[model samples]
Target: MKLSNSTVLVTGGSSGLGGATVRALVEAGAKVVIADVNIAAGEALAAELGDAARFVPTDVTDEAAARTAVDAAVTLGGRIDGLINCAGIVVASKAVGRQGPHDLASFTRCIQINLIGSFNMIRLAAAAMQAQDANDAGERGVIINTASVAAYDGQIGQAAYAASKAGVVGMTLPLAREFAKTGIRVLTIAPGLFETPMMDDLPEAAREALGQMTPFPARLGKPQEFAALACHALGNTMLNGETIRLDGAIRLPPK
Candidate 1:
């Protein structure tokens, strides 16, 4: 789908990877709706982008909130052309450590937000997209999900995080196939270490060390880079049902 004049909904859009995507989509001439729990950041971004963007408070895991976000996008742009799932959390806990078994609640929370939340947005956005007329390419909309390299090369402390991301990767093909008849495409982007808000908790040296681990470019991935890939995926209809790795050939080691 051509981004120019299209309408896209982005979750977790208040900051980090989702924030970059919102800016990029608006720059591409697409109307954007920022769906996030961060009211302050979301509203600020929407204001910064002017009429091209709107902020709708959303909890991706909640059905009503997700639907509201979709409705807001449709209202703002007249039709929803795309949905990007960028809302997620990271939980680093060893299954067996000094604390005994990892907190089950943390594991469940990670799954709820990272996995189930993504699906909530997908289902609602897709339903709205199906109601719209297809473009010349018989495409009504496209959906991009955010997975992680951890899903493939999970570290020792990433059981919850890895499992959640893995679920996202697992859903891509089946969702794409199911949506084929309706002209909506589903895809996932499994990114490696990147400079997102989630990385802020690390010390500067630690973050730098992690970046140097990448085989090439030898630095942390940028949010804009991820956004660029998302834009590309939206434009490339043949790229459906696939999980593309945005990592710089980095196979994470167990830590």
Candidate 2:
């Protein structure tokens, strides 16, 4: 769908890649809803972006909350043209840690937020988008999901993280097929190492070393790069039922 004058709901939009996507969509003339767990940051971003953006506190795992966030976008433009599922959390723990088995709660939480939460938004947004009339190209809306290269190249201590992301990757084709009748496309992006807030917590030396591992440009990806891909994915109609890798030729090593 065209970004100009479109309404898009972006979860986890308070910061990181989601934040960058909100900015990108606004710049491209799209009305954006920042749905996130962080109310303060979400509101701040919405206020900073002026009228083109609005903030709706959302927990993607919660069915009611996810629907409300979608409704917020519909309220802005009477329809949701796009939905970006970026709300997620990550934790690292080995299956057999020194403490014994991995924390089952942590693992479950990761799946809850990253996998099921993503599915939650998909169902609600698809339902909303389906109700709208199709565009000239017979397209109702597009759904963009975020995965990680870790889903494929997961190292040690990434069982929970990897499984959650892998679930996202696994859903792309099936969801796309199911949404085919409604002309709602489903696509996933698997990103590599990046310069998100999570990365900033690492020491400078450590961060540089991590970036150096990339095959070319030898650095962490900028959020804008991700934003660009997301915007492109939104506009491109032929990119359904696939997961695109945004890594710069980096295959992470087992640590």
Candidate 3:
């Protein structure tokens, strides 16, 4: 699918990888909708991207909110061309911990936002895409989901995060098959540790240590690298129903 001049919706577009993807799409001439819980940041980004971009405050966990965001994008741009599911949460805790017990509520919250939230957006966006006319490549839409390296190499304290991301990995193939008939494609990206606001909360030494874990390049992955892959996935029709790991040969060890 050609990205330029297409209507693209990016969840979690207020920060991190999502923000980078949004910027890339906008620069590539795509009309983008920044869907995020951070209203100020989202609106600010939309403004920064100029006329082709709009922001819609969205709580992806809520079905209505997800649907509304997609609807708003379609209504404003006249069609839905692509969706990037970048909204996710990470809860670092052992499934059975020495410090009391694992917080079930926290675990559930991770699943709700990271796993179910992605599904909600994909379902709503796909439905909207299905109603639109297919493009020259016979494509209706493309969906890109964010998973984590934890899904494959879960550290000791990442049970909930791993589970949520694993669920995302599990859904990719099936959803792709389901949407195939409608000319919609589903893909997932499992990312390695990167320098995002989330990682900024860590001390410098800790961040350096994490970066060293990468086998080659031996540094933290860049948000732009993730955005590049996303754009590649969107344009390369053969890439679908697959979860590509963006980790730099880094198989995280149990902490």
Candidate 4:
């Protein structure tokens, strides 16, 4: 869909990748809804963007909250034309560690937020978009989900994170097919070693070393790059049901 005047909902839009997407969409003339749990960041971003955006406090895993966010998106621009699932958490723990088996709670939490949370937003947004009239191309909306390269080249400590992201990649095609009848395309973007908050806690040297892992360019992926791809995916109706890896040709070692 054309970004101009289209309404899109972005989860985890308060910061990081989602924040970049929200900014880019606004710049492209799209009305955006920032759905995130971070109230301060969300409100501040919406304020900064003026009338082009709205901030809705949302926990993607909670159905009620997600629905509220959807409603807010519709209210912001009169209809929902796209949905970007960017809310996720990373968990690094071996299945069997020196202490013992990895913490089950942490694994479950990762899955709940990354996988289930994405689905929650998709379901609700699809329903809303379905109610709207389709364009000449019979396109009502587009949905983009965020996965991780860990799903494919998971390191030794990435069992939980990998599984959760893998689930995202696994669902793309099926969701695309199912939503085809409604003219709502589904796709996923699997990012690798991006400069996100997840890497913020690492030492500067550690972060630099991680950036060096990418084969080409030899640097961390930028949030703006991810946003550019997201906008491109939304506008290109032919791109659907595929998990496009935004990685810079780097495959993780066993570690």
Candidate 5:
């Protein structure tokens, strides 16, 4: 669907890839509901975008909160036309670490937030989008999920993170087929090392070294680039049920 005048709910919409998407959608003339746990930043972004955007404090993993956000999006825009699941967390504990063993709690948290949380938003939002009137082409809505290259080339100490993301990649086609009759599309974007807040925490030298792993560009990805591809996906109905990696030719080593 064309982004102009569409209503999209974006999880983790306060910052990083999500934040960039919000900006791009607003600029494209689509109304956006910024769903995020970071209320301060979310509210700020919503305010910056004025009537084109709204902020809904949300926990993607929370049934009640997620439902509320979907409802809010409908209330704000009359219907939910698109949903982007960007709320996620990462962990770096090995199966057997120096601490003796990986923390079960940590591993579970990674899955809960990244994998299960994404499914929660997808299911709920799909239900909401299902009830909407389809466009002339029988399109009800579109969903875009975020995964990572680590799901395939997981580096050292990425057991939890990799598994969670791999689950995301695994679910893409199945969910797409299940939602096919309903006219809602399911797709995932697996990004490589990008210049997000997480990367910002690293020293510049360290970050540059990581970027060099990607051929050509030889620099960290800009959030705008991610946003651009997401916009393209939203507008292209032919692209569905696949995980598109936005990595810059980077096959991470087992560092």
Candidate 6:
């Protein structure tokens, strides 16, 4: 769908990949709502984007908050055109460790935020989109989900994070098929390591070692690169029901 004049909502839009997506959508002429738990960052970004963007404090794992965010987009912009499910948590844990048992609570939390949260936003957004009049290509709306390369090439300590991301990868095709009749497209992007705030505290050598794993570019992936692919997926009608790997062909080794 053409982003111009459309209303888009991005979950976890307070920072990192979500923030990049919010900026991209706004620059593409879409009115955007930043749905995030970090109210300060979200509001600050919305304010930076001026009138074209607004912040809707949301904990995506909460169904009510998801619904409210979507409704806020419709209420403010008159219609909901797209949704980007970028809210997720990354906890490094092994299925079994030499030190002790796996942290079940942390594992569950990863699944809840990474998988269920995405589902919450998609279902609510699809319902709202189905109610609106269809657009060209019969497109009522499009949904873009953020996954991780760990889903395919999980490192030794990424069991929980990998499972959560793999669940997202698994959901794409089925949800796309289910929403096909309603003109809603679902797609996923599995990204490699990126230089987001999360990685900022890492030692320089550690960060460099991670970047060297990428064969060609030989550097950390940029949030804007991920945002570019997301925008492309939204605009291209033929790109549904698929999980595209944006990891520069790097297969992670067992750490």
Candidate that scores best on lDDT: 1
The parts of candidate 2 lying over 4 Å away from their true place are none
User: For candidate 4, lDDT tens digit of each residue in 112-211?
Assistant: 9999999999999999999999988899999999999999999899999999999999999999999999999999999988988888999999988999
Q: Candidate 2, overall lDDT?
A: 0.95
Clash total of candidate 4: 0
lDDT values for all models:
0.96, 0.95, 0.92, 0.95, 0.94, 0.93
Q: Each model's TM-score?
A: 0.99, 0.99, 0.98, 0.99, 0.99, 0.98
Which model, 1 or 2, shows the larger lDDT? 1
Q: Which residue pairs in model 5 clash with each other?
A: none
**2 or 6: which has the higher lDDT?**
2
For model 1, state the Cα shift of residue 32 in Å. Answer: 0.3
User: Which residue pairs collide, candidate 3?
Assistant: none
Ordering by lDDT: 1, 4, 2, 5, 6, 3
lDDT tens readout by residue for model 5, 128-186: 99998998779999999999999999998999999999999999999999999999999
Report the lDDT of model 1 for residue 161.
99
Candidate 6, residues 56-142: lDDT per residue as tens digits? 999999988999999999987899999999898889877788879889999999999999999989989999999998896899999
Off by over 4 Å in 1: none
Cα RMSD for candidates in order: 0.6, 0.6, 0.9, 0.7, 0.7, 0.9
Point out the higher-scoring one by lDDT: 2 or 3. 2
User: Once model 3 is optimally superposed onto the true structure by TM-score, how far is the C-alpha of residue 170 displaced, in angstroms?
Assistant: 0.3
Runs with alpha carbons beyond 4 Å of true place in candidate 4: none
